[model samples]
Target: MVTTQERVGAEPDFALNPSGQFGVYVHVPFCASRCGYCDFNTYTPGELGGATPAGWLEALRSELALASQRLPGPTVDTVFVGGGTPSMLGGDGLAEVLDAVRSEFTLAPDAEVTTEANPESTSPGFFTRLRTAGYTRVSLGMQSVAPTVLRLLDRVHSPGRALDAAREAQDAGFEHVNLDLIYGSPGESDDDLHRSVDAAIGAGVDHLSAYALVVEDGTALARRVRRGEVAAPDEDVLARRYELLDTWLADAGFTWYEVSNWSKPGGECRHNLGYWNGGQWWGAGPGAHGFVGATRWWNVKHPNTYAALAEKRELPIADFEVLAPRDRHVEDVLLQIRLRSGLPTSLLDADEQARAESAVAAGLLVHDGHNLVLTDRGRLLADGVVRDLLAD
Candidate 1:
C-alpha cells in the first residue's frame, strides 16, 4: 500500500465547465511480446505470472463503478481503449469492458469510441466483431515499412500486414481510422521514411500520427546505443524528418492539427483533443493516470496490486498531485501552443507578453489577432519556446 501526507487547502480553485468534454481512457497492460524500444508499463504473458485478463476486467469494472459515483457529471464524450495491445482482449473481452463503462456512466449519443490495435493481432473477423461491438474508430501501430527498421524496433507485423489491416478496418465500417508512424529509427533512411509515408497515405487513412523515435532510458534500445550496437538518433536528422513529414502531409491535403498529428478536415481525434483542451478524464487499469477538477492521480503500476485493491473495493491510487492555479496556467500554455488553434495572449503576464512579442519578431510565432500560434519553424523548437515564454 502507498501512503501520502494529507493535503490542506486542496479544494479546486477552478471548476470544470458542466458542458465541457470528459473521456474515459482504459489501459490494457498485457502484450504478447515486449518490444526492445518499448518502455510503457506492459507485461508479456510469461512476465504476467498468474495475472489473467479476467482479473484485469474485474478490476476495471470495479474502478468504473467507483468513478461513476465519485465523478458525477454528464455522459462521457469519448472512450479510448489503448495499450500494450487492446486487440489482444478479442471481441467479447473488449465488449465486456465497454459494457462496464456503459453501465457505470452514460455515453454521449454521438460518442467516439476507439481502440489501439497491432496489425498482426487484427483480422477481418476481429475488426467485424469490434464494429459490431460498438467501437467506432481504430488506431493501428504501423511504425515503419522498412524491413531492417522493423526488425530493429522488434515489431512483429510485416509491412504488408499493416496496410491490409488498415483496409480491413475500413471495410469493417470503422468511421474513423488512424495510422501511427515512427521516424528517426537508427537505421531508417530518408527513402525509408518516404516509403512509409507513401504507404500510409495509400492506405487511405483519414488520420496519421508520426512520432520521432526517442530512446528512453531502461529500454533495450537505450542499452544497445550505450554499448555501440546501434547509433543514437540525431536531433538534426529528426528535425529534417519532421519537416519532410509536414510538407508531404500538407501537400496531400492533410492539416497539422497538432505537432506530430495530421488529419483530413473534420477527422481529428476527438478523444485526444479533449486531453489537450484540459477536459477531465478517468483512467482505468494499472498505471493509468486520471485528472478530475484540480486533482491528478495515478494508479499503482503492478497489476496484482491493482487487482487486490479493486477486489477490496478500494481505490488503487498510488500517488496524486493537486494543481495550484499557476501550475494549471503553465500547463494550459504548454498544451495550447502545440495546437493549430494557438493560445490566447490574455493568459500571459506582462513579462510573458514581452517574450511573446520577441517570439513573433523572431518568426517563431505569428499573431492570430489576440492568440499566439507556432509557425512551422516554431514547432521544431516548441519546447524551447515554451521555456522562454515561462522563463523568469
Candidate 2:
C-alpha cells in the first residue's frame, strides 16, 4: 500500500519521492482517420461537431491535476503521449499538455518523454516544436512501406511520406526515433515484408516495433475477412515471417528487447520497460489505464463524458479493481515471462519450477543464473508456454 506520506512529499520545498520512480501516460484520442485494423478508443474531430471545441486539452489538464491531488509524489521518470495520432495535436496543443505535466509533477531532469506520430500528420516544423516542448523520443507509425500493403491497411500516408517523416524527425534533432511496422497483413508477401524492413533500416531509426496483425472481433479488418474481402495469413506463414524478422533485425544490430520490440544498444523505451518491470504510473485522458501499486483503473472512454466529469473535479474512472495478492503474483509472472529477462525462480512454486525445468531441458527455455528465459522456439509458442508454467 502507498503510504500517505509517500503519496505527498513532506517538505515545503521540492522533494523527490523516496521511491525514485513513477511513469505518466497521456492518451491523445484524436485521429484524422482510423486504420482498418485498429480498435483503440479514438474519435475524429469532425465527429465532435463543436460539442467541446478543443476543450480536451483543458479537461486533460484538470484530470492531471486531479491525479496529482490523489497521488502527489515526486517527479516522474518517464512520460509517454500515445494516441490515435498524437501529431494531430499540432505543436501548440502538445506544448500545453507538456506544460501541465511539468506543473503537476516533479519531472526528472533527464526524463524520457516520447510522443507517437503518424507520418501524414507530422511535419519538420512540428517535430522541431515537439523537441522544444521537451519530447526526447519520437515514434513514427510507418506500418508498411509498400503501396499495396499500405492500401490494405488503410494508412493515410504514402510510403514516400513515411520515409520522409523519419528523415524529418532525425533532422529535427530527435536523438531517439522509433519506426513502427506491422507484419502479417492480408495479401502481404514475404518480399513485401522484406522491402518494408529494408526501408525502415534505410530510414535509419534507433528502434523498431514490428507486430503481427491480430483480428479483433469488432474491427473492420475482421469483418472484411469474414466477407471474403481480404484473406488472413495462415499460422505457418506468420511463423516464417516472425523468424525472418527476428533473424534480420538481429543481423541489423538490434536486440530483441521484447517479443515485438527491437532496439539498438541503449535505446529501449523506458515507459514500456516500466510496465514490464511492474513499475507504478498514472494514466490520464479518455480510456487511459493506470496502475498504482495493486490497484488498476481506467478512465471513461467517451471524450465528452470524460471532460464533463473532470470539469466537476472528479476522476473519470469508469471501472477499477484492487487486485488480490495472488492475482498480482500471476500478473507479475505473466508480464515478466514476455520479456528477455524472464522470470525469477522465486516467482514460481516447486511444482511449477519442475514443469519449467522440463521445458528448459527440452530447449524451450535457457536458465540464466536465477532466471529462466525463452528460447527462439519458445517465443513462437510463448502464450502456451507461459500458461503451462503458471498453471496451478
Q: lDDT for each of the candidates?
A: 0.89, 0.84
Candidate 2 lDDT tens digits, 1-392: 33323432221111223463589999998888878889998887676545342788889989888778777565799999998788888877787778989989989999999999888888999999999999899999998878888888889798888789889989999878999999998789898989888888888888999999888788888899999988976888888899998888899898887888999988899989989888888889889998886677777787888888778877777766667888888888888887888889888888899999988988888898999898999888888888888787
Q: Give the TM-score of candidate 2.
A: 0.94
lDDT of 1 at 272: 94
Could you tell me which residue pairs clash in candidate 1?
Answer: none
Assess every candidate by TM-score: 0.96, 0.94
Worst 10 residues of 2 by lDDT: 7-16
lDDT of 1 at 166: 96
User: How many pairs of residues collide in model 2?
Assistant: 1
**Which one wins on TM-score?**
1
lDDT of 1 by residue, 1-392 (tens): 12343422122222445666899999999999988899998989888878999999999999898787676555899999998899999888888888988989899899999999999988999999989988999999999999999999999999878889999999989868999999999989999999999999999999999999999999989999999999999999999999998988998889998987999988899999988888888889999988878878888878898899899888777777778899999999999899998989999999999999999999999999889999999999999999999998
What does the lDDT read for residue 162 in candidate 1?
A: 88
Report how far residue 97 has shifted in candidate 1, in Å. Answer: 1.2
What is the alpha-carbon RMSD of candidate 1 to the true structure? 2.4
